[model samples]
Target: MMEPIPGESKKRVRAKPATKREMSQFHTDEYVDFLHRITPENAHQFSKEQSKYNVGDDCPIFDGLFEYCSISAGGSMEGAARLSRDKCDIAVNWAGGLHHAKKAEASGFCYVNDIVLGILELLRYHQRVLYIDIDVHHGDGVEEAFYTTDRVMTASFHKYGEFFPGTGEVRDNGIGKGKGYAVNVPLRDGITDENYRSIFQPVMTRIIDFYQPGAIVLQCGADSLSGDRLGSFNLSMRGHAACVQFIKSFNLPLLLLGGGGYTVKSVSRTWAYETGLAAGVELRGGKLLLAVWPKLTIGHAQ
Candidate 1:
C-alpha cells in the first residue's frame, strides 16, 4: 500500500472538476458529449458507440466514468494552476497523465487527455512548456495534440513497433512550424538503468538547451520498472527515482503526473519513492515515519 508524504501539511489543495467548456479547450465537443452520456446502465446499450471512442475492454465503461475523467483532469488543471500562480515550485498530480487519450477518441486506457489539458493551462502563464514522458508506452495523444504548435515541445521514451498504439516513430518530428519540437526515443524490451540513463540524460539535456522552456511537465509512469505486468523494461525503484531527481535539478515550475503503471505493488512503491523525493524527504532504510497512519510500517522484508 502507498502512504502519504511524511512532512506534508494537513491543509488540502482542493481541485474542481473540469467543466465541458474547459475540457473542450483541447477535446472535441462530440467526444466530450459522449463521455458525459456514458453510465453503467446505458453502457451496454452504447457498446457500438463506445467502440467508436475506443472505450471497450482496455477502456471499459464503469460507474462514475465521466466523474472519474473529470476529477482526473481536474487534478492536472489544479497542478497547472498552482504552478502558474507560483504557489509552489513543483506541483504533482499523481492521478493525471492519461496521455494516450485523443481529441475525439479514447485509446490505451485513457479518456480525457489530462496531460494536454494541463499543458494548455501552463501555456497561459508560460510562453513555452516542455512535456517529457517516461511511460512504457508512447505518449501518442499528447504529441498529436501539439504536433503543429511550437509553444509546447513533447519528448517520449517508450517501447515501439507492433506495440499497442504503434504511433511514435524516431522520425515523427513535429510538422510545419512545430518541426524539430517533437522528440521520440523508441526503446526495445529489457532496457536496464545504465542504458536508459545513458540515453535519457544526454537527450533531455539537449532538449533543455534548445527548447529553453519556461515550465516542465513530467509523466513518471512506473510500468517501466522490473516485474511489471504490462511493461518490458528492467528499471529498479532507485533508477526510476533518479529520473525525477535529474528533472528536479532544472528548478523550473514543474507539474508531475502519473501514467501507465499496471503492477500494483511496483507502482505504489515507485510513486511513493518519487513523492518522497519531490517533498525533499530522504527515506532511509528501516521503519517509515508517517503522520496519517500510525499502524503502517515501511521496511525491507527480512
Candidate 2:
C-alpha cells in the first residue's frame, strides 16, 4: 500500500536482519540460541525445550520463525538508530513493536521484543526515552524491563481486567529511583473517541511535560479501534490516528511502532493512515469509517 508513498523510494532503506549478538542485548543467550536452532521439523526432538520456553500454543514453532523475529527486531533497531543520529525526525516500523516477549520467554504470540531493543538503542544517545503503548493488552514485558530505571519512562493505555498478559494496573508504578516513571491507564470496554481523548490528551500532556524525554517510542496498536476482533475498545480510525497526530505535535524524534491489531482491513487502514500522519500527510478526509467484519481475521500479526 505504501509502495507509491510520496518520496518513499528516497526515504526508505532495507532493514538488515538483526544479528544474534544484537538480539542478545536484551534476550537470553539460551533463548536466542533456541530460537536460532529450533524448527518445525525438529519439534519432536525438543519437546522439553519448547515447554520450557513457553512455545506451544500461542508462540508456536515454525519455519523461518527466527528469521522473522530477527527482521522485525532489525527494522525497529534501525529506526531507533536513525532517530538517535538525527537522520530522521520520525521513523516508522510497522513490522516491529512486539512488546510481550520477555528476556527468556515468548508470550502472546510475540517471540522477540523489538520495542525493548529499540529503546535500549535510543538510551545510548538520548538522556531519557518515553515509551507509550496504546495496545489493548498490557505491554508487560517492556514495563518489566525498565521498571527499575528512570532513564526510560513507560506509559501504557490498555484494557485492564482479565486481558492476556495482564500487568498494567494503575497502581503498579515504578520503584526506587524510577518511582512514578511508569504510568498505566487501565480502561474498560467500548470507550468512544471523545471519551478516550478526555483522558489520553491530558495524561499524555502531563507525562511529556514532566518526563521531558529526548525521544518517544509510540506503540500505535490498531486493535484499540472499534471493530478489532481481539479488542473491545470503540475507537475509530480518526480516534486512533488522533493519538499519532497529538504525539507528532510534540516535535520530538519519534519511533512509531505497530502492536496488536487482528482485523485485517482496519489494521491496514489504520497503519497506512498513521504512516501518513508520520510523514506529515493527511491520507483521509473529514469522516472516518467504522464497520466490524466478523469473517475477516488475521491471526496476531501485530
Candidate 3:
C-alpha cells in the first residue's frame, strides 16, 4: 500500500508537558500531588494512597508515571488550543484519549482524563464541543465529567453488558442542563461496518444539526476493530476509518484522539489509516481504501 509522507501532508509538533495548574483544572489537588510524589520505588510506602487513587492492578505505580500523565494530557490540551486559536482545521493526538481517568482516581489504565482536559480547553473558545467515542468500552469517565453541563455533548458507541468500567447505557442521558446531550449507542458483539454506520450517520447528523458545536473531539479507539485482543466488535479497518471520514466531512475544527486498543499491529495500522483520512491523503493499493466508503457532506454548522 502507498502511504502518505508525513512532512508533505501533515506536520508533527512536540507538545510541552502539562503543568500542575493545568491538570488541576479537572483533577483534585490531593490526587495530582499523589500522582506526582508516588513512584515504583516508593509505591509500597503509599499503600493508602494507591488504594485511594485506584492505582494498583491496571494502573500500577511505575517510573515516570507523572511524566506520562502530563505528556498525554499536554498533547491533548495543545490540540484543543490549536483548534481554539484557528491554527489548524484538524489536530490528531494519538496519546491523549485516556478517557477512563477521574477527578480523584484512575481506572482502566488511564491516570489522567486527557479527553476531559481537551474538551475543557476547547470550551474556552467554543460555545459547544461534541465528543465522539468509538472505543469498544464505554467512555464512562468523560461522560460523567460533562454529565451536568450542555457546553459539551458526549456520544459513545461501545459494548455495554458486563464490559470493563461498564456504564454507558442508552437511558443514561445527561442530567439537568445536559439532558439528552449525552448519547450512548450500546452495541453487541460482532457488529459490522454497515450496521455501525447505519446507526452512526443518522444519529450524528441529528446531533450536529441540533447541537451545532463549534469543535469536535473524536476518540478513534482501535479496539473497536476486529481482532482486538480485548474487544468483541467485528469492525474492520475500513469500517473504523469510515467513521473518521464521515466526521471529517462536517469540516468542523476536529481533534482526533486514541483510546483503548490491545492488539498492537492492528492498532498501529488503524491509527495510521485514520491519520491519513484526517490529513486528506488517499491511501492507495488496498481494495479497502478504494472508495468503498462514501464521502458524506452533511449540512454546515449554523
Candidate 4:
C-alpha cells in the first residue's frame, strides 16, 4: 500500500461523520458568558507570561476562539457530569482536552481546560477524581490547576527535558496533601506502543482502581500518535485507544479528554476513531482514512 505524504493536504479527507453530544453545564451562566466574551484580541487581558500563562504562537488567539473553546470546556465538564449522574461508564470528548489553558490565561494550544473543569464538576459528587494524561506534551495547566488539591489525582506521562512548558519532572510530585497525587513519568524518546500499553494501562488500572476513584478523566492526546509532527512518542491510535478501552473495561466512570494533537491528519483521525470506539458509535461507509505512519518498528513485531 502506498502511504500518502505526512501533513500533505488531506482536506479531501472525510472524517467518519462523528457528532458531539450535548455537554452538561457545570459552570455558572456568568462564567460561561465570561468565557464567551474572550476573543483573540481581548484574550490578551488574561495574560501571565512570566510564569505559566501567555498568548504564544501555537495558542495564537483567533476569531471564534471563545466559541470553540467554550464548547470544548463544556463538553468535558459534561463528561464529568455523566459520571456524577452515573449515566455512562465512559465519556470521551475528542475535541475537549484543552489542558494548557490556565484559570486566567491561555497557553499551549489550550484556550480552556476541559479536564480541570470536568474534574471540578466531578468533585461536587465524587470524593476523588483521577486525571490521567498521556499526551507526549506535559499536561502542565491541568497539573498546576489541581496541584495542591487532594480531590484530584493528576498523573501525567509526557515528554520532558527541554520539552514545551518544561514542567512535570519526575520529582515535582505534588505539594501538601496532594503529595504523591501528581505523578509524572517524563519518558525518554524511542518509546513505542507496546511499552506504553504495558506500563500505562497496568499502572493506571492499579492506582486508580486501588484508589477507588469515583470517576476518571483521561486525556488522550493524539500528538502521541505515531508520525506526529510535534510529539515524540510513537504510539498508534489503536494503542492509545486501548488505554481508553482499558479504563472503560474497569467499569469505572471514565471521562476521556483530548489533550494535544498537532499533526492535523494523524491527530484528527486518531481522535475520531478513538472517540467512535469509546462512544460505541458504529462508523459505517466512512472514507478510507489514510495511515501515513510507517509500519511499526521497535518490537511491534511481538
> Model 1, residue 10: what's the lDDT?
18
lDDT of 3 by residue, 60-95 (tens): 888889998998998899888877887678888888
User: lDDT tens string, model 1, 214-290?
Assistant: 99999998888988999999999888889998998888887888998999988988888786666665566844544
Please give the clash total of every predicted structure, in order: 0, 0, 0, 2
What local distance difference test score does each model get?
0.84, 0.86, 0.87, 0.68
Residue 123 of model 1: what lDDT? Answer: 93
lDDT (tens digit, per residue) of candidate 2 on 1-302:
01223343216656777889999999999999999999999888888989888998989999999999988898899889888987678888888889999999999989999999999999999999999999888988899999998999999999979988878899999999889989999999999999999999999999999999999999988889998999999999999999988998898888899999999899989888876666655664744343221111111222
Give me the displacement of residue 15 in model 3, in angstroms: 0.8
- Give the candidate order by descending TM-score: 3, 2, 1, 4
Compared with the true structure, model 2 gives a TM-score of 0.92
lDDT top scorer: 3
Q: After superposition, how far is residue 32 of candidate 4 from its true place, in Å?
A: 8.6
Question: Lowest-lDDT window of 10 residues in candidate 4?
Answer: 293-302
Every model: Cα RMSD to truth? 5.5, 6.1, 5.7, 10.1
Better of 2 and 4 by lDDT: 2
lDDT of 4 by residue, 79-120 (tens): 666558865566656667778767666678776667777788
Off by over 4 Å in 2: 1-5, 8-10, 285-302
Report the alpha-carbon TM-score of model 1 versus the true structure: 0.91
Scored by lDDT, model 1 comes in at: 0.84
- For candidate 1, the 10 contiguous residues with the lowest summed lDDT are 293-302
